[model samples]
Target: MATALVTGGAGYVGTHTCVALMEAGWEVAVLDSLENSSSAAIDAVAEVVGRGLRLYVGDCRDNSAVERALTEAGPDAVLHFAGLKSVPDSVADPVRYYRHNLESTSVLLEAMARHGVRRIAFSSSAAVYGLCKELPVSETAATRPANPYGWTKLISEQMISDVVRSDPRWSASLLRYFNPVGAHPSGIIGEDPEGAPANLMPYLLQVAVGRRAELPLYGTDYPTPDGTALRDYIHVMDLAEGHRAALEALVSSAGQVHTYNLGTGRASSVRQVVAALREATGHPLPCREFKRRAGDVAELWADPRKALLELGWSADRTLAEMCRDAWAWQSAHPQGYRR
Candidate 1:
């Protein structure tokens, strides 16, 4: 088994990816600061693997810390998932967002360069394609990020591209993820957003769990079938599997920077998602229409053909499966790891 270093492996996506890597027989080492995440996430990840994982409590911004972690982990490849990801919060505090998201990556890249870690898989977001004219977005779509958070991710992608191009020895994979929802089938660990949930699934889950009174339906006047915003909601497990496939590609590639869109190549409207959640949870979620969010887009999904064709990766989970798993986790842990 090859050793893989996972930065921010205690995060929602990172924790799931760590478990996926371990399940695939990879020796995983996690470097996390426990800022936005809790150490309990690592425990949940270990529970998924039925054993312990190599975890180091550290931040990605500290070059020395990153250097020590990578050196000690002796990773053949690195997965970068450490960064702040909140659109409204980023809008309120742009500099903080830029500093954390960009600076952390710069530090991680420098550490990887110094430690001779040649391969990397970056966790990017579909937010990079803000207000796209295309329905199902491709990797080559015009990337005009609507919010500061999206811009930071785009800048990070450019940075990775530049670094990889400057050195042929560095092979990188930039995975632009669509909306990631749901949880593991075991319902042990799942999306646990702090404060009010910004994403739809988590917000809806909170409502279903009776934490929130009702779902504030944002923007019910879009040009979609349900006249609400539409997006591609991929299961987190599928996203984890896609990361595994991407890591395989990064290792097998000819030392070139590659980018892929991680999605299910399908779109679901806000109302559609609510309906699916209601069906999955057997709860009629109360929702009220509200004004559109400032940076909300009408419709945004992904054209994941590149991943399917190149990496042999395709999302096998359905929307019903996503809602079911998410509801299961929410029902099991209403407080989300606090209990």
Candidate 2:
């Protein structure tokens, strides 16, 4: 059986990807700090996949902890997802973003080098391609990050590329993600951001579930159809499957750093999202307008043809399904894992 050690596996994407990997017959071990995430997610993953998980509760930046996890898990590859992910938070505190995101990656690479784990699948972001001049951005677009968060992801991608280029034996997949939202269809595991939610989908879920009074609609005067910023939101489950596909490709192949944009090639406005969630929950989903925040672009989606061609992976979920599943999880676990 193939073994994989998932850093931040207790997180939203991490937990869902654990379900995908386990279902695909891979033994999964999780290393998490449980600082911005919860252990309950692991339990939910176990419930969904009908398998127990091996987890190490520690930050990824800790070299000893990572080394120990690597030694015990005996992974074929490492899925690096341990990083602070709030764009606004990163903008407000670039130092924290830089220290945590970069250092964690650096330490994980060092540990991987020590343990001879040559294959790595990095969790990257579309923020790296900031202020995209083109509508459907491809993988080859210029990476000029508008914010510290984007710079971190772009720089990390470069770091991974450099390492892989230095040693041709090292192989890695940098999956540059668009906005990942929604929950698993089982509704057992879903996104539960610590403190205030940053993304539009989570904020909508919170408002519908009474966690918040209303959504704070940012940037209502953009060039998009509805004036709000446009984003390419893919269902989290589809993204999990993409991760599985990427891992399988790595297993069958070798000696190259593969980068692919993981996103649905469709853009949705904030108002459209509000409408979809309203249908999902039968709530008014009130909203208040706010000025555009830093580190945000007017509109951008993905040219997902590369992923579809190479990995044979394309997101097939609709906006309605995304909202329905997300509402299912949030309504069932209103206080998140606390319930």
- Quick one: best lDDT, which candidate? 2
Lowest lDDT block of 10, candidate 2:
247-256
Q: Candidate 2: which stretches are off by over 4 Å? A: none
| lDDT tens digits by residue: candidate 1, 128-197 | 9988988679988999999999999999999999988889888889999999999999898888888999
lDDT of each: 0.90, 0.92
Which residue pairs in candidate 1 have backbone atoms (N, alpha carbon, C) closer than 3 angstroms, thus clashing?
none
Candidate 2: residue 170 lDDT (0-100): 88
Q: Can you write out model 2's per-residue Cα lDDT over 223-315, one digit (the tens) per residue?
A: 888899888999999999999999889875567989999999999998999999999999999999999986578889999999999999999
Which regions of candidate 1 deviate over 4 angstroms?
none
